[model samples]
Target: MNTFQFPMKMVKRQVYDRIAVQDQISKTELLQEMDITSSSLNRILDELVREGWISESGQGQSTGGRRPTLYRIDPTHRYILGLEISRVYSVLGLYDLQMNTIASYRWFMDEHMTPERLVDYVEERIDWMLNDYQLTWSQIIGIGIGAVGPLDREKGIILNPVYFPANGWKNVAICQMLNERTGLMAVLENGANTALIGEHWAVRDENMQHMLFVNVGAGIRSAMMSGGQLVRGAVDREGSIGQMIIQTDGERLHDQGNYGALEAFASVQALEQQVRQRMKLGMDIWEAAEDLRPEQVHFDTLITGLNQGNIFLQELFARSAGYMGIGLANIIHILLPEKVILGGALINANPSYYEQAIAVARKKVGYDDSYQPIFSKGVLQERAVAVGAAVMILQQMEL
Candidate 1:
């Protein structure tokens, strides 16, 4: 929308990003941050307003004659579609420019939610939302996908990830499929990294130059950001955190073949298996809820058992929490981040698990009034990846 010749595209985007991140910013702040002349900034601001991306919010107190105009991203002019496709479930949200959700849908993954079926579901959801809002497709910018890894981000494809409920998940070009269906560009990113982006966006003013986000679910996923950029390994192995060796000869392993791993003892699957083994030994905690199969024993039942004061569950969860702490401690010693965010189904379902893990981590690190990173539960909860993917879509925008 910006047809200017003097102000470059990159510089214009830089200005837009600053305004979009902040709740509100003044003209003076923009001039100081951009280091550009008043005339150039004025031109860029006008273009963004005309493009319906940003607008003058209000007046800022002035040092001189007239008050300076404040700027903020326009909330309703444009929209972005963000999707989080994970092994456990998937979410779709339509967000405005300010990352506010307009309409959203979520579904648990089952044996039938294949890649093609997922695309169809996304298309139907988007159409339903557009009709409800009375907005046309032209107002929608593009799509952003935060999916489980290992992903070929360069190719916008979902690479092979284990333990998915459905078959035919290997090497799916999900980004392209969405683009073809919606007629908008699509960007692919690791769900964990997208969640990190989402958390960082929420805490952009906290001065956390080094931050780590770890998601614990059926598997462990992790992403780090340092100096405002994501820390990426050569391969897209966000789930590799699950494979971190917690013990050399502990004798347990994931079905995916990681021996003596933290996930073997701490993952939801591992906890379920442990609970089943205990039940076989005549443990009497099942009256808290329906007696489910080992494969069906998920966080819902576990949380119910925990609430019923099941002693066996308390001790078992304590051990799993301890393993989680050791894994986090190892990462902390290596990364030395300013903040560590813990999220996912397990942490979200059980508050005690989170508290215990953090306590163990602090003790393992020798808590002596030293510089320890602040550990937090992700405030965005399950929506982190989807909202983060939307933020990434905004970041990839061009003038």
Candidate 2:
């Protein structure tokens, strides 16, 4: 059966989504939760099962007279492809209906990687993954890409992404290209926004109505969810917080040429650049790692230096954390989300950095107890963007 040919009715889609999230739900429970009539609910359930989207899992405990039949999304019925594209690397994964990663792969993004080349690489990898898993293309419901932007999300195009080397990549219709190659529905979204969706679904916190997700990796970006909906601004660049100026005299980031931007002071790229600059001045920044040259310095090297008692690295991280705190404080003052989730390679590599940033953020908030927000680390780690991309596709699906 075609994966996307499932029930299209809003009620039916709701039923499938509910069962997908709850894992298993009794017919009686679904009846109570959904506003449809008993006959209508039964008809929808029948259609879902007929379409291979759901199955009668088993019987549930009896409330009084008779046991109710339990329904669950068929995990093997369909699959989703999630791709996360960054300036440094890309990640791709195949996820089951329940958002479990069946398989995943990561590859570095070279400067020569143009839009066509990137699409070709992804298509090849996707074919291999499908073959390895003994799955067919028909089973793939869709493909979702989490990419750097300013994107034209509605057009499914990548528009002049900062730091991307290939000049031809500008105005690339990524979704159309992938769709043509793979014969699957494709979507493109900002990496940070996709990460936020992934975190929200993974956490499954029903009470989380407002949230802020900060990604502090090669560059800093954020996504906000207010009142259970993503706050995509008029141009869908609402969460491009990296461009927010944090200091009047801070160094400019090379990509956007935005002076004193939050990313300039807090991103992994910023940290590495600072280390490189210090090395040029004859500082022993590479003392922790033997044979590591100044030009070879990267985020991982700095993380290693910090772990090995490098005083300079420690001070650098502390200072970066302070800047991050200030940036987060500004975000809080504007958004005032109930929870702020911090994630990225740097934050995940060292929890202390996030803690330090949160400490400073709390201090900056001052005596405003009403402005308190729960600051926490992201749960999905490296897979957040990929999984979130797939989840976004799933969310848009009718079933």
Candidate 3:
């Protein structure tokens, strides 16, 4: 193959990507974004149309005389892999360039699911998915992983995520391992950041300039977007947002642990602990379910109790939501974002919990007299991280 052939091919892909993101683009827009001469760009566009990678989609409004033809990518012509890895479970999905979910699979994490086992599962699933879709390796854009942090995103490592079920997860080069197995390029990012990106894509038309995404579950995952760009840190410590000290004399995780961090108070694990401790101290959660062991006090059960009008659970969850609100207020005070999106199965399971968190946050922010931020539930919910992982591929500079 000619060395120039690769660069030319990449340029064509770049052309297709521009069209893909915009849904439709005209010659003028292409000319403005790309440095190529008009003739070269026309040639590329014509070649793309001939190759069936892109198509002429109607026409744009007339500028001076005749209208310009618009171009769009053939959405089905390519596929991307989106993966979200967390302490509880992982999601893998096949996505079109248009962000459609062609296929998806999920599995819960356990003590036995080490890095090697995870790769084994992913390799096998990708093989099956490709065969089922009747697609080949060459048609794939690449794999994107949205996972727990702190991560070494540049080096493609999962670093040290807290509360991981299995051992041997530290310093795992999962991106390289997946790339070696599937022979596709891979990009890794903090799950929270990916979820925020996914939310960005979901509301791209709105062009939200400032927003916060917080997933309140086993852990508190968070990411911020400001001025139409994600607020990234020098280190990909997404969970660090959870580690912010909320209580000066709160829970101590370890000797050096944060004294009442947001996660310490707002997370599902904390809720579960509180419930079990209360139950042990003669607080009856349910009359019939007296056998509810320490391990059995899950978010679902708590939500179920709330639905049944359990006052004890109502007060307990409300307190948790209040803490969550404090976390939101702290971030909102600094970023003063236009929107705050709350997600995670536990938070979404109860409408009252969502309301209370928003209420507490707004009350503390005290923006009612001035500029108040909007608060809403996460648009993508649990799938945000996984779908956002795929979106990250679209944003990959190399691609």
Candidate 4:
């Protein structure tokens, strides 16, 4: 763990966390809370104010001599663009300096399975979104991209993204490319981390310092937050939990290198595959799914049937939830987050589907209500990653 001195990164984060609470914070209280001398803290606050990232909000009640000034982040001093890139769609949103979403747009692509298509798809949406908002490029302080990994954050590239090779984006420099194309600064991060940041910043819980971001969709990952900062351990490969072997002897594939992993059971592709395999056995899930739209399988139908007490669907979901529980239990034992926030399509399709899994996790975690970890759905819902990306830009400004 990195130690903190006065006028350092940790001190700044401490101040921001406090300011984040009351929408504004007083200087004396912050200095006292952070255990920093007034002179040093004032110097740092002055730098922050001069940067236009923070401003005086109001006068606080006088202690004895003079009333102290309250400071808050400049809500419109700058803006951030949060771009969430997925295999199916790209969601973009603009946020004021205070991490509030001002505008957003969702763009879908038929074939973003390659680097060129991926880049083009993002560039197009970014151009249209900025134009529609009538905001000059200069107003955008920074851009943050939430994407699938294993990624090269330094290089700003997705490294061999699974199932999307044709998009011409294997090792593609997403940050540099977007920076050059849009003339804005950019940071690339894991989708799970983005979602986690969204959840963390949204809850207004500065005290809930440690938590886990469990994304359950096309894949499953675990992003851990400890002591306020994200723990991207050892080369930014912290949350790649898709391949944790949950079953010793299950159907195996030579796909992403982990045999019979949780992804093989819980991912959207896995769910679709289960439906397809059931179809071969005289159970046509396509009919049960009630999918009419072209190229769009109705996952909601599966969820509906599971909710309405379809035995076969229930069994399928139970087993999938079991795998999810296995994954969650492993994460709980290892990282021990205070809470686990679930995100992604599979979880959103039917949160009930994962209830059995949570039960199983509870069994493994034993009983402890005081510091027990509770599982909850992400507050941002579908927009979690995008919003997190925007929040990332705001945080990067060191506000």
lDDT of each: 0.86, 0.85, 0.84, 0.75
- What is residue 307's positional error in candidate 2, in angstroms? 2.7
User: Could you tell me the lDDT of residue 262 within candidate 4?
Assistant: 83
**Segments in model 2 whose C-alpha atoms lie over 4 Å from true places:** 1-8, 165-168, 288-294
lDDT by residue (tens digit), candidate 1, 1-399: 466643578778888888877878987888887778999888889999998778888998888779988889887877899999998889999998878889999998888999999999999999999999999998888889999999999999998988788998999999889889889899999999999999998887776789899998878899999898999988999998888999887646445556788888887777877776666676665675446555566666887888788887888888999999999999888888888999887888788899999999988776656777889997687899999999999788665
Between prediction 1 and prediction 4, the one with superior lDDT is: 1
How do these models rank on lDDT, best leading?
1, 2, 3, 4
lDDT of candidate 4 over 1-399, digit per residue (tens): 345453487677666657766777798889767787888788878887897768888899988978999998777777788988776567888888666778887865445346556567667766776788787777788889999787888788888766441456577788988888778899999888898888898885556788898877766766988987898777665336877888777764335547788888877667766765665565545344554332344355567667777777777877888888888888798898888887777777776766777888887786666556878886787889999988887776654
Candidate 3 lDDT over 93-194, as tens digits, reads 999878889889999787898999999999888888999999998888999999888888989998877777788889999899999998999999888889
User: What's the CA RMSD of model 1 in angstroms?
Assistant: 2.6
Worst 10 residues of 2 by lDDT: 1-10
Q: List the residue pairs that clash in candidate 1.
A: none
Sort by TM-score, top down from the best: 1, 2, 3, 4
Alpha-carbon RMSD to native, per candidate: 2.6, 3.3, 3.3, 4.4
Model 2 deviation from native, Cα RMSD in Å: 3.3
TM-score of 2: 0.92
